[model samples]
Target: MLNADTTDPAVLRELIAGELAAARERTGRLTDCVEDDELVAQHSPLMSPLVWDLAHIGNQEELWLLRNVGGRDPMHPEIDPLYDAFEHPRSERPSLPLLPPKEARGYAHDVRGRVLDLLAASPLEGSPLLDAGFAFGMIVQHEQQHDETMLITHQLRKGPAALTAPAPPDHADRLPAEVLVPAGPFTMGTDTEPWALDNERPAHRVELPAYWLDTAPVSNAAYQVFIADGGYDDPRWWTERGWAHRQQAGLAAPLFWSLDGGQWMRRRFGTLEPVPPREPVLHVSWYEADAYARWAGRRLPTEAEWEKAARHDPATGRSRRFPWGDESPTPAHANLGQQHLQPAPVGSYPAGQSPYGVRQLIGDVWEWTSSDFHGYPGFRVWPYKEYSEVFFGPEYKVLRGGSFAVAPVACRGTFRNWDYPVRRQIFSGFRTARDAGEEA
Candidate 1:
């Protein structure tokens, strides 16, 4: 949402300040909803204790904006190693000496207060980190990403439902099952986005063959059919690696799902309910997505293909920053920013559809693509390489679009998310794509 168009420093200050405030507000809500003991406890080995994230966000802000950019000394330098993500894995974090919930909150708030003061005095230009308020924007994004991580911790926590929101609106009309995306060249990455991280840089052109993409993300009803057809048992529907993982992990269905009284039920945030027939399937691993696509005689879209479907507007021969256009997301455009606890129905968010009439391309659940997590041509490390560079390899698969847990500041057409192929604890889903043939 932080565009490169702002030249007025005062307005830029206000914009950056507002986004930072919004992120902190959400962070506060997610942490404050639970008690101190809950914040300190690691609900799952896959996630860090919520308290670590609370103070870490502040530590990163202190390291970057306050010290690196603002020339201020670290407020709590002795605890830096404890909060460094790379220094300690999520599973081992709880054993480290961590700040308590109250102290973490105070540290984060104090860091924020100082950062805002720095924002007011800085020129916000003339340097790569300060130009377009990129550093501040990055910190805001970093915090929001942590906020999403904390929300996932909330989901992983065992308790009564601690979160609630109104359901997404229904789309009155049914949508077609597929939309045709013509084969052509489209820009694959962004060189101009103010806050776009290093990986989505050095804009380059990519050519893709014509393909038919699902009009909406694969729905629970459709995925149920796959499960019913013994999709998980059919080795033919899975790649060798996928089959191996499926068997090794005993993956019978999406995470949080169970069968009860012949009804498909799932635990959401702590409440068990029948799987919503029309919502996009959630918490599926990339391999499972691939297997499901194979079961349906289709395939997961390539990263380029997914981007084209979400961004390219052939009529104008240009790409938009989001499926709906270059504007920041609104509640009506997509189910983003924790606005809803789960995905909207498949046919919903008509306004959020891409030019090709592809719906839910930006949010609801991150759609897995059949692509490796490698950088594009001319990709260069910025600020630091550890954020993305260390993860570049076939060991990880890429996921496109944001999820309902995503903050709008961290979600955009060019945004890239990657996770290990077998990991499904994260909110993830997929829509199938097929090559065009005589059916076209």
Candidate 2:
């Protein structure tokens, strides 16, 4: 299916079921790579144990698909408190009575079986949940998100390599320094998108002055220039808060990067290798991305500007669902779905470029924007308030596009991800922008 259009109920059901299976398979692959001990291990204080996530995925599936959709009684109702996210913090999850790996896998598998049977028989005409298979989409997106978080935990775990993939090829090129997004009004969010979350609701218009955005994400080689020139040391390039954080944290370079014997090396999934200069830099904090932009005499694009760059087509005056257009992403279009362990070299996916010739706008790295996370003009709490309502504030900064770790269903043009500005453990990078008429 090209999109979540409700024109054909049978096609919609098939599409949702296929994507749901794919998401479950990805979660299985990630969990299977590590030992059972690793599944129970707490890799980081900020994340729950892998086992918690495993059962949490199953719990959420049972809640949404089984009880809610199929009108079935809860299969494991007593364990609800153990998996309630808001009821427990990440650091405390290891203490909870989480299901063992074997039990967790069986529970999730059982839930999937019932959910699939329901999908095969359920009517899809009424209620928002069944409208174009929105609930199934939500579950798939949720599971895939946890899969990405699990991948992060793998990165943090201390062990021999548990995951492997071929390296992304060097495809960087001397493209335009910046692509011009003309001054005008363009549709911002989506009202018609069947599965759009609350934060991206009620598609509206945003007027932006002309600006120039980097044709591709900032690369490791480019970031190295910042480090060599003392970008971290210079207070002028950093905001007062950022400088203070830098001083307190003693940050010298992007997380996982170090200069050894005059060559830059990085630890990736328990393996150290020379930094791939052409690849988009990953695991940098929003503060780091912001400081890099300042050092280079540019600024991080606003969330609106980033969206316009990715989705707006001036010729048609419409917003597409992706940088490459309304078509769903394919391997040829992006390095998504954890198919590759690392980002493709900047400018690798020419086919994925936006209409404005901006490349790598869909995947490779989650691109940080200058905007704070907030609700749209006419936003309303939907499905659940915790999904987005609790996050509408300046406490978090928004990241756009998606990373190689993100799944296609969860990485659409309107999808939004947010984190604290100091977070660097995530798969993130940035591209700088400037006012169209500003001096270079």
Candidate 3:
């Protein structure tokens, strides 16, 4: 439930100003300890150069929100050719000539300031300029996106020494295994929402029969049962593709896991410690989730079913941006803001439960769905063509919600992300669902 009055020009300006301030502060922290040369070095495959990423954020705002709508020239016309991400995809990222680190930071600060001033002076409410609102939204999401990436990237470069240790896992209690959802029609996506990505538009109707979904993400203790039962060795539990992948890679369990003195230990950040049975299982790919589901006599929910259980407020036909409604996220609500930067004990945030009583729906670990990564009925390409069109096929599967490293704003209920079936470096996990009338 976003402020329905977000369209108020003054409110929008103030919001934009606040977000700009936050972005600057976060970005400053990311670059604070880096040297001039280190900023341009390729730290990891998951991250781009810090200097390049910083410039891209500012240039993106100028290109899409200001130039596209306000018809203004770029603050630095010459740098636009080098730093524009929309024009250069990730594959070409390494080859781009980058600005000096200090210069890049200054350019970003200058551009952000100019954009804020422009937004303050413009009449955005009813004018055609209103469409730029989406661009503003996009910029906000983009900045948060990099903030999360920076966290992971820093870990890769400096090892786990860069991050603070997470709180010890709590296994003192375990929640009920499942919650039953009644049979009904739940709106699947957004239609006329003030701001929605193209993938979330044309809010179509979907009817799902009654089902029982896990009240929380699968826990380490449960997944350990799968491993102990030789679940990975049994071909019957895996799809043909999954079996092939398992055999080819000799994967016996989740990455970053091992046995120590017959007890399970997992790698978090960089330290190895006893596996916390209550923590949601993580780093499992879609194939792994599917295999685990099959072994458990259940299945991953379709994106529609997942949304019906996790977002739709049956009483009002409205969905929350987060499972907990419109309030900005807090550490108490979910495992966001790098609070722990590791999966929390499942069901740790009862306040973050969705309307239908689905717990941990917003964050803990991203959940895999059975949906293919495809666009909606009237899908049209945005400025970044590669964003959606290139990934449309069986090669990728849809993932819902956000992971520990996810930024709060980027974890909105309708924001969609996709990954290849076998790539599982991300902090991903799954919950099980059974058909109507099934026993928990």
Candidate 4:
């Protein structure tokens, strides 16, 4: 809640610093799970080397915090060109001069030290970047995002499991099919959130008719039905582009799933096991989710509808920062921050339920929505153009609700994540929606 309560500058600074430190700690933990060689290895052509992301996180922090926010000199000017994401695609990162794991760790550590010092002396007002501690929050969010990317690299890497987490609490209760979001106009996006990125800015009212959203994300058991019904083979359920991509990729099941001895199994991190029927299905592309919705006689919720379900509080005509309430996420609330390598049971985390009784709307997996990644009405790029402006197009689909691999600081009810429809490496899933009058 970096900007949720920004009236007290001291408190805001402390929260910002704490969030930054926590994000750094998580990055270090994820990187430490593997050796230096693994860090340098490009796990997938689609993702940068782990070492590249490690340094790039530090590079971004230095450029934004030390250079822009504090008006300090660049720490390593030579490395700037190499780490620029747009300049070097993931496929070319390994061929570039990336700092070794040890050096990258030192650089990130040093950047954090300086950033903390700047935060201590920096006034928390003046420009928008400092007015609400936006820069610090942005840096924290950027690092957390990269940490999530690194986790994806780990997922794509062919190695023994290098990460570990205890299983989430067991919950056996069955969830209802859908929850009705009382229709009308509900506030969407945020004008007051200090650290909200450009795409999520300028709070606006979105009007929608009454609709029904799934109580929780589609579970593995539910997705299994789609596979059984030849959801992939049937062209009727897919969009033109989606059907084309499906045919080209020859996708039969989710990315890491396979059938062994007539039992559906999935590769989780480093081990293969029977797919957990109760868990939210992970690593599904937007196309697959869309087709599944069609097969189930439902549709992916529009971004507005999804946000309305997660943020709108019908009783008070207000939007909560998270599904549960205005308070920040707690351990009991959501399965996030890579605390668990995989999603918890779909019905778990009852405390995180929305006002409409929508469960797991904020965690589990990055739930897909039907909307494209377009700028909000009155959206304007602030601070930087590339952070969001570059990705504003129909080619990318929006995904809401942070996944288990997502960090709390990087997630909010308004936070937006988008990717190509064919991307299944990131933790993604979907829950279906339909008009309120529709029969189930």
Best by lDDT: 1
User: How many residue pairs collide in each prediction?
Assistant: 0, 0, 0, 0
> Model 3, which residues run further than 4 Å from truth?
33-38, 75-92, 126-132, 158-160, 165-174, 316-318, 380-384, 437-440
Q: Which stretches of candidate 2 lie over 4 Å from their true place?
A: 1-6, 169-171
Cα displacement (angstroms), candidate 2, residue 208, comes to 0.4
RMSD of each: 1.0, 1.2, 2.9, 1.2
Q: Write the residue-wise lDDT of candidate 2 on 8-77 in tens digits.
A: 8788878888888898899988899888998998999978899999999999999998888889998988
Q: Identify the candidate with maximal TM-score.
A: 1
Q: Residue 301's C-alpha lDDT in candidate 3? A: 88
Instruction: Spell out the clash pairs found in candidate 1.
Output: none
**Predicted candidate 4 versus true structure: per-residue lDDT over 77-179, tens digit per residue:** 9999999999988899999978998999999899989999999998888998888888888888899999899888888889688888888777635777788
List the candidates' TM-scores in order: 0.98, 0.98, 0.89, 0.98
lDDT agreement of model 2 with the native: 0.90
Worst 10 residues of 2 by lDDT: 1-10
Worst 10 residues of 4 by lDDT: 1-10
Which 10-residue window of candidate 1 scores lowest in summed lDDT?
Answer: 167-176
Residue 432 in model 2: lDDT: 95
Residue 390, candidate 4: alpha-carbon lDDT: 90
